[model samples]
Target: MKITEGYMPYLNYQTYYRIVGDITKPALVLLHGGPGSTHNYFELLDSLASDDYCIVMYDQLGCGNSYVEGHPELWTPETWVNELIALRKHLNLTKVHLLGQSWGGMLALDYILHYSPTGIESLILSSTLSSASLWASEQHRMIRFMSEVDQRAIEIAERTGNYESEDYIIANTHFMHAHCAGVYEIGKAPDCLTRPKKTGKEAYLYGWGPNEYTPTGSLAGFEVTD
Candidate 1:
């Protein structure tokens, strides 16, 4: 199918967006994860192009083609939600189906709760954490299944805030492989799992803290599920 791409201007920054399939069909707007994650990994959405769904994907202001980096203070969920509104208006999206993943889901929830905007057909939240506390608890629960070495590495990393260490990375990778989508017992990290994702450190550090188990960023507080 035909793919259309453009930069939508928002608050002195340009959000890079791409559309697959016909605009006449039901529009499905996909919001990516991370205060830092790019939209590249959502390639699976392309199939929806032929299924009568207008698949839209975009990298938020601080990532991918937009690359409006170095402004961590400005990376608030409100700012991102505003950008989403801008993009919707720019594209003249009257009726939309919003699908957000992880932090993207958090942003979507924030927008609905704050603005209560209409015209959304549905909201699909994938692998989202309702709150930082919930995320931490889940990570801790998952760690119990790991080996002693991996568990030690993860524990030490969390204790010392040394997520950058090689041991921490290895341990984190193993944990991610198991819980980040793996189905087998262990040692079955898929190619997609092994691949490195494009993430902005400034956005992550300012928005999500030093690591996954910790919550010391702008979004440190707030309860979504509770």
Candidate 2:
């Protein structure tokens, strides 16, 4: 097994990436979630390397080691989509599998729909939704089941724009653990679990809003309406 790490230029920026396992074998590109998240959380997929597949993981520009400025304007899905294309080409991967989690999964779908890209052996889209409004709707359904106190707190926070309040964070964490797919026991969260909290906030807050339920951001109105 060989591990190679480097940066590839993309649209005036450098996208950082890592390749695990044998480059000659079938490859899997891993994309992390968040318009501003990193690839570190996907490290658990290193286990797939032992099975004879190349595992490629990268931090999109403005996140992790990509080193570009984390401007909200650069957080568009198209930018990340193009970055993935540049990464695949720079790595010289002709035929490969792709697995993207959450926002990464969304990127994967966008790439596929845009090009119906050939040489992609398969794709694994994990914990992602095809529609943003639908996501908000689903969020409503999910939150409806929480305790009445939490429900009222979330509503107050959203209405007051007080998302940082202790009541809001506590209620948000409760909702997140049940829905965010990566949270854990408070004292036992590994770096992967805590990383997105450290990455691009403007991107997350501006793109997806304060939380899953309140998508008052750029992506708030997005959906596959077509």
Candidate 3:
């Protein structure tokens, strides 16, 4: 399969994207989680790129291979929605299917609500929370499930508001690996995490928190249920 790459100029910066498989086929756009996450996490999506669909993946502004020079305010869902619209127009895609995971699903919802683009054929939301409150509730549950020692560490970190501490991060990663994907060993890991250029870290720091159930970043108060 041939892969083509390019940049789509947006208001604040350019979004980098790649197209795989046949462009003549129906388009399937993959939206990664992390309001700041790159398309790298969705490399497993390549499996769907064969003859049935044209796979489109891109690093949203401020992430991955995309331009990172911009104001933090530009990270809002409104800006990302515009980026998606620009990319769709640049590709000249008449209609396309969308698959979004976690924060990516929120972006998709924003796009559908604001633009209501005729080009949107379908939407797939995976492992996503409908609102920030729901996410916070889930985090509490996850923290409760942790071992007593780990739970105490998290409680201390939260009390001190030291979310960036190594202890917090370590506990958070363990929780994610156990509950998020249910994979114990690294060797048996999923393809997305095994990709050479994974965007999990950058996205987590900027958009999500150190854990799947926690929201410690700018998106902490973000709610999509409305």
Candidate 4:
């Protein structure tokens, strides 16, 4: 059970990465969600090292340990794809397995389709989307089933594009609890979910918009269903 962590150069910045388990073992590279989320959320996955795979996790360009500020241009999927390619080459991951969750899943899809690089052994997509528009629609549909107060709060926020309102935050919290972390009781999520440090808020807003159910950013038109 060996663990190592460090930074790798990406573009003009540094990307922080952590490795758990035997380095000689085949790499099980993880892709975390959030065009802005951190790899810290994958902390529990380190136990897989005992199962004989070297677990690799990293903070993408603008999130967590690898955070950078004021570069909204880097929030696009293309930048992340390129960063992943660089990471693979840097780590000499000749044989790799990918487990992508949510936005991370989308990044994996983009990496494979956009680059079609070799040496990828397997892909696991979890709770992800191939169509941003479809995801948004589904979220809205889910919202329709909530209490009228929740529904109206969300509706008013969406209509006014004012997500900062207290009512909207309350509504959004309800939606998150029901859909995002329904498995855990309120304020009782694991450290992964409750860890300190801000997720790349600027990037999240620029790449995926202000909330989970909306899409008014660069990824608003993103789709790979075809």
Best-performing candidate as measured by TM-score: 4
Window of ten residues with lowest summed lDDT in model 3:
197-206
> Where is the poorest 10-residue window by lDDT in model 2?
191-200
Question: Which scores better on TM-score, 2 or 4?
Answer: 4
Model 4: per-residue Cα lDDT over 39-152, one tens digit each: 987888888886467999999988899898898888888889899999988888888999999999999998998898998999999999999999999999999989899999
Query: After superposing candidate 4, which stretches have Cα over 4 Å from the reference?
Result: 50-52, 183-190
lDDT of 3: 0.75
What TM value does model 2 have? 0.86
- Compared with the true structure, model 4 gives a TM-score of 0.93
- Candidate with more favorable, higher lDDT: 1 or 2: 1
Root-mean-square deviation of Cα positions for candidate 4 versus the true structure, in angstroms = 1.9
C-alpha lDDT of residue 225 in model 2: 44
Ranking by lDDT: 4, 1, 2, 3
Candidate 3 local Cα displacement, residue 40, angstroms: 2.4
State TM-scores per candidate: 0.85, 0.86, 0.83, 0.93
User: Positional deviation of 66 in candidate 3, in angstroms?
Assistant: 1.1
Indicate whether candidate 2 or candidate 4 has the larger lDDT.
Answer: 4
Cα lDDT for residue 112, candidate 1 = 79
Stretches of model 2 off by over 4 angstroms after superposition: 50-52, 67-70, 181-198
Better of 3 and 4 by lDDT: 4
Q: Is candidate 1 or candidate 3 better by lDDT?
A: 1
lDDT for model 2? 0.79
